[model samples]
Target: MAKCFPEPYDAVSESKAELLLYKALAEQLGPDYVILHSVAWISRPGGSGPREGETDILIAHPVRGLLALEVKGGRVSLDYRTRTWVSIDANGVAHDIKNPFDQARRGKFALLEKLKESPAWKKLGIGRFNIGYAVFVPNVGDGDRLRGPDAPAEMIGDRRDLSDLGAWVGQVLDYWSGQEGAGQQIGTRGVDALVALFARSVSTRPLLSARIADEEDVRFSLTIRQAAILDILRRQRRVVIAGGAGTGKTLIAREKAVRLASEGMRTLLLCYNRGLADHLREQCTTIGGLDVATFHQVCHRWIERVKAKNGRDLLSEARANLPRGDEFDHHMPMALANAVDTLGPIYDAIVVDEAQDFGDEFWLPVEMLLTRPDEAMLYVFLDENQDIYRRSAEIPVQGEPMVLDRNCRNTDAIHAAAYSHYRGAVVEPPQISGVEVNRLLASGIEKQAALIGTLVTKLVVEEGVAPHEIAILLCDPADRPARERALQTLPLPATVKLGRVEDFSRGGLTVDTVARFKGLERAVVILWAFDRCDVGKDRETLYVGMSRAKSLLYVVGSREACDHILAAQT
Candidate 1:
């Protein structure tokens, strides 16, 4: 049967008859036609830029190219002279409406224009495709109401002729197959390829796969190393767990805090990054007796609490004396610890994520905040390879760290690319399969921008990737604005929101510097390394950026830059 992207049951409808007709057509056509329901225009009709044009049913046939059908459920009558349509309701009341045939024609051209602008058609070597438009009045007894100069013989049909939509579709396909043009006459291979293209376009299979990937990411599976860490936590009050990127360091820390909180322990979950801390807070809030905050947040709160208790405004004093720069974040906790000593230990258990981001000076205050400095439960998760802040103070670990080696995020292809730049001795293997890492060589910034635009367009339009699922990560923070400009150069589908990570929180493609996207992951990543001077010798930064992708990774840069990265492969 015809494969419907969304089955008729799930689709929203103005009337039940419309849904019934869609289901009937799907049952009639057997696996040859790919039918899409509620296809909207890439751009608005008669607008300078793209706008929404709604189409009821879209059919993609191997030989016929594309067809848009405007289905009218009730008895629809056409006034030839007035060029208007009157749809009769169940109450025998006629309501004047805009001509659906005209609407379908506009939708047809709108979709055709959209396809023409996309790079997918050119890549597939179908520069042009024959587009057909029809108005199907399935409930009308006589086809005469819908027929006139406004409705062509082939473009207008009723239930009598359109009921067996498969046969009608076959006739249209055969007619288009015999036409003379660059778009006509598909070879046997071409037919299959075209049909597959349409299937991918309308299918929700990718979303299902994405959901599975999301499940794999959010739900933790205990690896041998993770199990060992849990075992260590059970016995040891002071523990340090260290591993490379994608080694599930963050997952372990979150789970440890969750378990402690679930046991009714007054647990404190801390991280260096505010974004990561926010994520932890959300995850840990479900359990009781947990307080989640970043290192700076903890310090600030400690200062505030001390001031409130002693009636002394220490925050104002520290703010006036604190020096500003990149060192601000690294030094704030230490400054707070020096100024405040009266605050006693408030938490029974403490868990730190991204512990390497803090210095040794910061941990003394963390220790003081515990109920028992020597016996209180303390778990610190560390990955030195991801120590982008370059803290020099060595964290005091009493014994050997429990190392996690298996990666749960990146695919084999992604691991291969990231491993080429990895500095640590420990290597992580891929957990999932079928992901590919693609590399492109560009001569300059402009060339790289063009390449990014083309590749992303093809991926969204042809391969059917959700815009928000794709991220454009830049090595240098300065390149982010320029990269966003390049994204605007692309004529992507209107559904894509081209906003930065700071402003946009909803779906659409995200363009951000790799540093800002450190704690985030996407289905697909496009890493732009146009100006490598920013991270010329920093392998950790490069490695972190490369490993952010969960499935597909696209690395674009100059040949020299590309070669330099490839040379690091061991």
Candidate 2:
């Protein structure tokens, strides 16, 4: 009658001992407790790559708080000299395994750290209950050789503890869970909250999947200027649309690709950002004859095709033979354009997003890829105010540039904060009503990271915003690791996943650099500005980060920078 979370069986192992123990506990403890299996946590290494580890079993009781158990089956041997635990199989071969006690302890620390971030843990007042750990060896009974000074009596369990069901529960509650069986307990309200918290923490559904499912409820309408650009795109073969953030540039590009594909035109969608390109691909995959690629990806694919045709990778040869600087993007296209006659256009139409990020040299090869450079359909979307990379390429176009001035994404209050960076830029007029942007001032980078974690938790747990709707964007590339480490320490809810923008879901939060999220929007954005405090030097970059939020925005930075930003906004 006990509630089980994510099922009790393990696909990785064939052991039935853990389930047997579960059944015994259910019969003893009744339906008041919830059992969670295979709960996992990501371990962030200091110098090495992150590793993920899972706990075998977690039992949550209203009276006992929480218990983590490491369950093992079959014959187990302890090499007291090497201090190693091994499982001896039927063939008499020893399989090296982690110590069950150590495994259970690690799970305890991970869960404690995770719980530290959740407000629910504090709200339930279950903090008073002891978080316990134990090791269950159901196959091994209390024998002559097994019980010794090395074997801790309370932590280890054998057949004797398993035989008398009612007595075993009493022993577990007393020795393992640290409860004397009465008085030291949780109320019904506290029990309910703890059960819900434990269930969510161990849920198997990926945060991104839930967010994608929730995106159906989000509503957005194209502005008059946006509709006009689409109308013009229907008639013109080649056109350029320029607009600032929230002006619907990405949306326009996506719609054009889908429409062209619907007409059976082979369309190629291009963007400078790989993450945005990935998102575009997902959005356009349903349409036949529509392909999405980043500028570098397209170049790599073309090089691969050339290698297949002529048995030589021209791009690699060009990189080695050609006299070029560190600007690979600028030099790559120029180097390849010299051999453009060898390659021909592959698509009926090409739609480029984030055009401002491309240099002048990068476009020649891109233009050469068009089957009919002049007659074939081409649509380029750009916003000069968002040219954070400082590329000054005049986007190749056939006619007067179409401009979208209405901001359909951000509210009037959010626009006020973003527009403070550029005094006279012809940006979009804010159309939505939004929460007032806040300037979170911290003394240092470490403090800033801590502050951001707290703010994100508050927004998700207390403010009722979905984890996926929130984004923490770093302004400088150098600050990625520090920001990631800081985010790891926060006790974030289980529903929010930290990931890159291209593959993110609406059900979880995303932590990425500002550049990767150029074309994306979030309901709440916390812009980390600790790297470069000078707003004058990086105005466009600051503006790009500020304009990403649709509803709420918190600009987190050093004290001096935050004060300066607040003053300017006023």
Candidate 3:
């Protein structure tokens, strides 16, 4: 009978296996055993229909009256902890199966009531008959095994030996029949009354178990670049991340924060600029629940509620708690001393963004934030090339800084141009494709603006790009006037602005200085009013500016200005 049933029994094969297993059992047990296939037992009082309950197989012998058997064909492994038995394939992925032990228990009670309704039981003059249950795993695997402790009416083994199974079923039936009159009688009641009793009993019994099958796929460690960064954060008590523009320092810091949080460690994410800090906060929020705040906010809160052993009353005072501008540049060690006085007894983990813009004075407060050396409490993210406002030396700290060269957000042409412009710098371009970089020479600011208008029109009308995708950058802060003049002359409806806002949501070109648009990116980037004198100082900045474009880059400047831009690329 087992041989006739399909191998690797799925939904289509389930009915076939049930029929085969029942026929074999009936042929061995004779007419005394009343066989019931696909018997659904709904434990809910008012529930109706076949869908209300789970169905398997049930058998009732006359002398050994009511019995239930749940059948399956395959290898099964039960996780004792989760109380789940998982079926596995050749590659070791889990196959789904209903819990046989649970099915048998439910079927036993349901069949007991069904047996009491029979006319044969009345003719036999039996007040109450015995009830039995069993589960058969037909094709057991050599390596597969069960995990949970054994239970009554739960039999898990091969189904091929029907004779031995029949004998076991008879024994179970005889045991229950002997104790029938001794115990309390299950009243001959309606389906509703029986269902109510079943519901109460089920609440005490375990429902279903969960399990995970062992997989064969090989797992690997992090890449060399990722490992280098993780190693630094893991080893150092306090360290700063400093690198060239587009090095992904902030991304590394964010990834570290997430990893530490997942490990149940308390971590704080800090950034200097509000825009960058807002961006970090949004990213953290998307990652679900995590503790993150800006540096100033953290300091304010700490000052408000000093609870640690080294807490000070000075932090509780509003005027004494404010961060002064002068404290930003009073040398590294002295700055550390002052900051330590203010924000002492450091956090468990501190992650700072835009570390380069922070002066030597910043490190003073940072040093005081380290609560332990071996526990590793501080991490900083910075881009050295983006430091256009400060002249402070890079704070020398422990930990080998990891460098990320992957230009994941830009095209190959943009990366190539960026690398060519900053030749000796540590800007390693990522492997990518699809973009064009062009250097257009104009007569002056007026002509540069005119050329930019033409390029924007071409990118929008001809290339089918959106206006919001275009960004016009000015190396000189004064070049904003020329950019605005160009916007006024263009036929397109758009506004020039220093940064984005809610009102300027979409379908408009934005114009800003290179420094102001440092962390932003666009689809098309146009640079206006470049001069020969600004070439060397703006080399790295220009690289960062051009790389912001996803598909196109247009640089409009005077002949000499254009020559300098083109020459720097070579």
Candidate 4:
């Protein structure tokens, strides 16, 4: 097989044409060939808006030299009058695209100029070798029919040519051999020079941020497999999605909200956590019809709206009659229901995440706030495994709930550690083989804090990991204050920033409990599982905390706790 750049191709490449050509080139070509996908460069830094030239696929063969291939996938046709290429998308939408042959020619020249800057190119004098350009249209067949004034039949690879790529390459080489300065021959030494020159631009450590991106790449592939469900959601009036963590519930909810709002519906996206709500709000800021907030935010907004209109705060009157704990439990949601009743239905649709935390009282006003109670779209995403808050969660929706089975967020190691305590339907672990789950033993609270602090310092100062990428989660929120005090005791550098998730981007390190940090992820997570083992409720808390780490995970606890984890892994 041919050696490919990045070893595994990026899952989210925009051009399906290029991905198809990349796989074919990698599998069918001999070991001597090197294929690079999406070879991009900024040609002129001082240009008006920075000129970028990207070759879809650059194939290097020792004897054939470099071939710049531009691929066009969908139904391709040409406008005779304007000289523009037309692409018919899956939706039967026709859009004008640039001529593929012209693109290949430009990319070929730009790459040649860039490659000449390498010291090896001048020393070996391989610049005189055949440097060719070709257009590969995987969707269109019969290369002879594709011939035009600028596009020669022999220089184009069509659908039929894909079956025998080697034969097609030979034909292309033969055609290019007749060109100027053709076939001086790029020998083994010349190919080595090209590969060596390309390697220098990409030599660096795979940081935590990069690994998290790799996880997202795998998640994206899995998410694509789930795209069929979007049609089902569109047809249904109400849906309650049931899944375990990493099954892409939050991702689906975000997409659903965006789609509904884009269609001019007044949509409300609700979640349990404030941090998650803030993140959603940030994502949908430019989206006009989408109102994303927490359950509490919905109550506060409605209650305040009523007060602003009538100059009477219904919530304050309700709070006077309710007990201390009953304020949020009964007073707030009831006031919201009353406020909704007065204002009538304002939202056309409502989507909820972490629905497992929403109580029966919470659902009363949610359904009432929808413009058409019977027909309005309602989506509820829930993972019962993460019911740490333990509410009634009697979501007022009707359906034979859709189940998401794959856990696409955490790696195999993090997945194994978390799912051990979970008691639910099977959720398949991620396929990526990430770093091993580390169980570091520390007897006391002080020792645990010291271990985490030292590790954080090493990650930030020594290893060059950004401070904002690390999060320290406490198993028990009650122990959060003591842990924070302990972590601050160490004489660490001022660069190591530690705060809550709201200030997380400000400080590289965030300190929060597992409950608050739910529905969020960081690159590195130091979980303080020390002596908080209750075997009952703590299992759910442990599951949520451990899974929050997307890349690197470390559990600091007592020797017994460490031993328990070790035994489970074995």
Cα lDDT tens digits for candidate 4, 473-532: 887676677878998898666877678877756445788888888888777888885475
Model 4, position 480: C-alpha lDDT score: 72
Question: How would you encode candidate 3's per-residue C-alpha lDDT over 1-570 as one tens digit per residue?
Answer: 221111213113344456666666655665444444554431212211111243355554433455566776556677667776777654677887767778776667655543343333333344544565667665553322452455443244354455465776666566556655323333333222323222111111000000102211322223346445554454355566655544556556777776544333456777655545655665567443245665555554554454353454433232345445343254233433444565555445667776766665556565566554334456777766666655474554665655555454456777766656554436555555775668777686667666777777777677767666677877667656656766677665343322332122345566876766665566677876557446566675676677667567787777777667667555
TM-score of each: 0.58, 0.60, 0.51, 0.62
lDDT (C-alpha) at residue 562 in model 3? 62
Candidate 2, residues 302-379, lDDT tens digits: the string is 776677787876766676765565436644575456446577666767899999898887888888887667667788
- Number of the candidate with higher lDDT, 3 or 4: 4
Could you tell me which residue pairs clash in candidate 1? 1-31, 43-50, 43-51, 44-50, 44-51
TM-score: model 4 vs. ground truth: 0.62
Which parts of model 3 have CA positions greater than 4 angstroms off? 1-224, 227-244, 286-346, 370-374, 394-396, 421-427, 479-482, 485-489, 494-504
Deviation of model 4 at 90, angstroms: 29
Preferred candidate (TM-score higher): 3 or 4:
4
Q: Assess candidate 4 and give its lDDT.
A: 0.76
Native-to-model Cα distance after best TM-score fit, residue 176 in candidate 1, in Å: 86
Q: Give all candidates' CA lDDT scores.
A: 0.68, 0.70, 0.54, 0.76
Q: Candidate 2: where is the Cα deviation over 4 Å? A: 1-211, 216-218, 335-340, 423-425, 502-507
User: Which candidate ranks first by lDDT, i.e. highest?
Assistant: 4
Candidate 3 overall lDDT versus native = 0.54
- What is the per-residue lDDT of model 1 for residues 90-162, given as tens digits with 9 covering 90 to 100? 8899989888878888887776655443333434566555667777777876765566665655666677865
For TM-score, the strongest prediction is: 4
